[model samples]
Target: MKMKKFLAVISAALLVISTLSACSMSGSVEVETEFKVEEVTEKEGTTTVAGKTFVVKTNDGSGLNLRSGAGTEYDVITTIADGHTVQIINQQGSWANVTYGTYTGWVNMDYLNETTTVAPIVETTAPSGATSSPENPDTQSGGYLYSYAGFNPAEITINDSSWNLTLLNRHYTLPEGYVPQLSEAVRGSGVYLDYRVAPHYQEMYDAALQDGITLTPNSGYRSYQTQKTNFENKINYYVSQGYDRVTATQNASRVVLLPGTSEHNAGFAMDIGWVTEDFENSPAFAWLMENAQDYGFILRYPESEDKQAITEIIYEPWHWRYVGVDAAKEIKASGQVLEEYLGVR
Candidate 1:
């Protein structure tokens, strides 16, 4: 009886040892189980991770776009209205993965303001000296003002349609939902421009063709969202080349203007032929240098250090802007950029 009791005790000790060995062999089981739980929660349109609340703040009052992925190339899930709050789950560079109501997506962190509590709306009358009227509303008293100060985004909202020479750099932006009356600049080529610019561009194209040079319109009339996608793509390209998010954005802006600040977004610009410096050496460019102003077009970005300083844009030989025959002639004669001719610089 004593021997049998000792054998039973030894068997129990061996069973405990085997259980520990099994656990050691599958050490990641607990971690895998926990990860699966989080994945299930995410699939259910909820997150188990703790998050902080942030409010959407934008200059144009257009709110912010929530995307399926962290980049603008991703599909838009929805547009979160300005002043709406979102829960930030994680951050990747300048983008934040967030949840707003039942939807979860990513948004540009630049447009978010952190707050522990929602701020109350305040009402106040305009200042005593401020003057606004139907004839000259406050937003359109004159042409939208452009600033020379560097790299400010969406400072002014353009409302006046008569302001064809309206300056749109980083400082001035079009109103939200603003889309100009558009027509195909080159029929069947799929390029479009504002109605006011189409006839002039067609005339210019015909004239170039008469001179045995074909000026092909490659791009024109980009929507605000399209511009955003383009800008973000350029930024991504730079980031892929070892640039950090901040530097990537800065570099991208030099080539692709921020969403609302682009002339393409305004529908008053066109990119012709090859969009490269090599266009500067083309016969088509030489023809344009001599006669584009006659048809109300001007080389929007010229190769001059002084102009680049004021315009804050690199020389793009193929980009042209339509600014009426008179304005174009004056600009060409004065050897000045649009900013300088308009006395804005």
Candidate 2:
């Protein structure tokens, strides 16, 4: 009987060992199977376009302007800045069709670069001792560090806000570091316009669009330094045409404004669509003539005014300036230049 009991105890010991081994194997498999290794493939936060990625690169403050069509003449949709990612749907000679956030437009190919992968821009806290507007620090604040920044007349009033009616011309200049409340009219035009004037321009643009007319603001805000560069380029072009230096300088001044004196520096002026005399004959011009004043703007220089005697600048239908609505109406009624309306001339 004692021998029988010993054999039975051995049998139980063998069964216990076998059960423990099976449990260990099952545990091992569970641990190994539960952990998964995933592959890191695409760049994080990068936009995918046409199965390829392109990044925006703009060193100048001028953000890449996205247009309804391929050319500058097309309606501006928005402006995008450096480090932004876009997907290119199609490419023409100099423009690329792209879509960003439910808006699609053409961007200048010169500003786009194909890249392996890139992430969207992340905002960092402002540095010490610098306060930026909570609204649009990039546009409204001064210290535009780059050449693409816009300027506001330094002496613009706070007591009786000029509301974009302030006069700036050859006789006046915006003070250095005068910053206007700027907002982008489109996503990527990088045109930091006066906050007050941008809305009016858009309303006018929309109004014109309803009538099948397209009026695009090709040039809006310009820094004094930019104006200087344009002025010098104009002088150089005239000199290349065999004009004497003195004659070229004077001629350049008549057309290309002296750097400090251009109305463009004020951020209130806009050069729309075209710069040639032929612009006056377009349907858009006729529309502007009959209706622009209602939107609080005036043709800064009209062909009817004696260019030499009245404004000293050549007549240009493309240039328009913002005055207040009431003032614009009166000026339109009286047929006076801003100089005559304000009695500055």
Candidate 3:
């Protein structure tokens, strides 16, 4: 009876060991299977399986513009070069917006491929400060860090609260640090504008002379002290004319500026008072309008009520500011105010 019990115990022990071994094997198999599935899923997610790049394939020329957005009225950021590469940025109906540089604009889907893809990270920052132009910064005097930045006859920088743009002959380029300080300056005084708008303004001066209109740049850059005096004088004049602070300040802002808000502070823009009177209605104005684009200048305040209101200043028809040849030509051809031409408005 004792021998039988011992053999039965041994058999039970063997069965227990076998059951444990089977469970361990099953667990290992499950772990391997799960790992394989996850690996496959991860591979599928990152796989570059379906995309392709399409070159400009047609000889039939068409008018195409790279808009700031998907619509026609949106700003035209840049025109795509014939051989330039564009990564398809998905499609909305018949149009596909592709990104080039810091701008995203629409292109016809027929000209691109649905299967093509480009994973370019688009930068939406404007061309200023940290987001400087693509060309080498050292190559040309492009940055706003020169000895003179943001000085106008008027003292305040003409930019609004946003400081994104300024009012000059055209769109004056104010970089990050050269923004206007308004709240601090009292409104009764003329507003000064400090912005480096020179490179563009100089181009216009040269262009005007080319057209037999000797536009003398009477004032190019002015010191802050000079702007302060100009503002105070305007305020005093207005106060003497029976105008209150608000009215006097507004009127002063038209032709003068509160110290520190003037464009003269930038040392770029200038007041080009003609040798003779009737400069705006003279040949000088006509010549500037005709040939300023070739030399890179634009009459800052266009003679339109709507545009003048946008500029928040009276039309100084003689004042032409330079923006650069490419931008100037675009502005002149468009016949739109600087704000409109720049699409800032």
Candidate 4:
């Protein structure tokens, strides 16, 4: 039975490979083959392959384990330390086979970067302006906003037509039986809640009201198909406007969560700000800063000089994510990014 199961798994893998045989990059055909259980014979001397680099923001204890092949450890090299540069000879799975001098080994490809040097960490001398988390008192937790490592890509949903997982940007309609009630004073108020944050968004609205700030919802749910079209539309619009693919992708990436990688998919994130510059700068924004966590929300992105660590494509003062009141309050008081407050790191 074990042999039969193994063969079946192998067959399924082969079928997937055959289906993807046409996919290639840079004139090189990428063959989809079954995950081979066999070991790769290590070649003596050294060989080089093209790759990219990235700097390490934190120390992941798993030392670069030198493997002769994928998933097989022949040796462990200890000399390589955090913040050291490595030349990647090849990439397999999530591990990058890297070489530095005589040492050749595998490192978690997640931490590797095309840039080796990270900007030095600067301590904020000013008193923290944000709410504090009750979860941990030693330090504020806003560090998650500073590092992409805090992001859990696995939580992101990527479906054929819809993605409803964490960290996904999706299109949805307000669930049946859901209706938003506007306070009489807030009606005709220019401020609108991005519908991407909907019925689940009431918690935030109520919390803001408690602080004497009347916020309104503008946009909410979007379908996956809508996201796909929006993505292509942005690509076309940017290219039409003379923006290259890279810049356009970057610009679009900020506002439009790549179909499968948006937090808006959770139906728990909203963008809020005042009706005018004066309103935006007024006590409403300040109230959000002081009390948003009470409603299970956190400011998604905050301004910082260090841009390399935070992967946020765009900066928005109004965007907030719901993580439940307890977590939100803890995160707010802790002063950590949602990613860190969630312990994604």
TM-score of each: 0.57, 0.53, 0.42, 0.41
Stretches of candidate 1 above 4 Å error?
1-151, 155-161
Q: Ranking by lDDT, best first?
A: 1, 2, 3, 4
**Residue-level lDDT for 323 in candidate 1:** 88
Estimate, for each residue in 1-345, the C-alpha lDDT of model 3 and write its tens digit. Answer: 999999998997898778768879787543222212234433312213212343433355432555544556654433443444455444455555454332235555455533344543312222223212222222334332211212223223434443323554313433324533322111222322233344344445555556566655544444555454454445334444455544444455655544444445554344554311245676767776777777556677666788787776566665555565777787778778766766663
lDDT of 4 by residue, 217-307 (tens): 4323333333444444443334334545445444455445554344443344554542112324756677777777666567666655332
For all candidates in order, the CA lDDT equals 0.72, 0.65, 0.48, 0.46
- Ranking, TM-score, top scorer first: 1, 2, 3, 4
- Measured by TM-score, the strongest candidate is 1
Error of 4 at 108 (Å): 51
Clashes of each: 0, 11, 45, 31
Tens-digit lDDT track for model 1 on 1-345?
A: 999999998997898678767887988344222212234323332333226678889999977987868898986645676877877656776787765542356899899988796332111122343222232222332343211112445556555665579888866777647788899997786778988899889999988898899988867887887777666665454444455544555656676787788889888998886554667998999999999999999999888898888887888998999888999999999999988887884
Name the lDDT value of residue 228 in candidate 4: 40
Predicted candidate 2 versus true structure: per-residue lDDT over 200-260, tens digit per residue: 8888888999999988676787676666655554544444445544454555666666565
Native-vs-model 2 lDDT? 0.65
Q: State the TM-score for model 1.
A: 0.57
lDDT of 1: 0.72
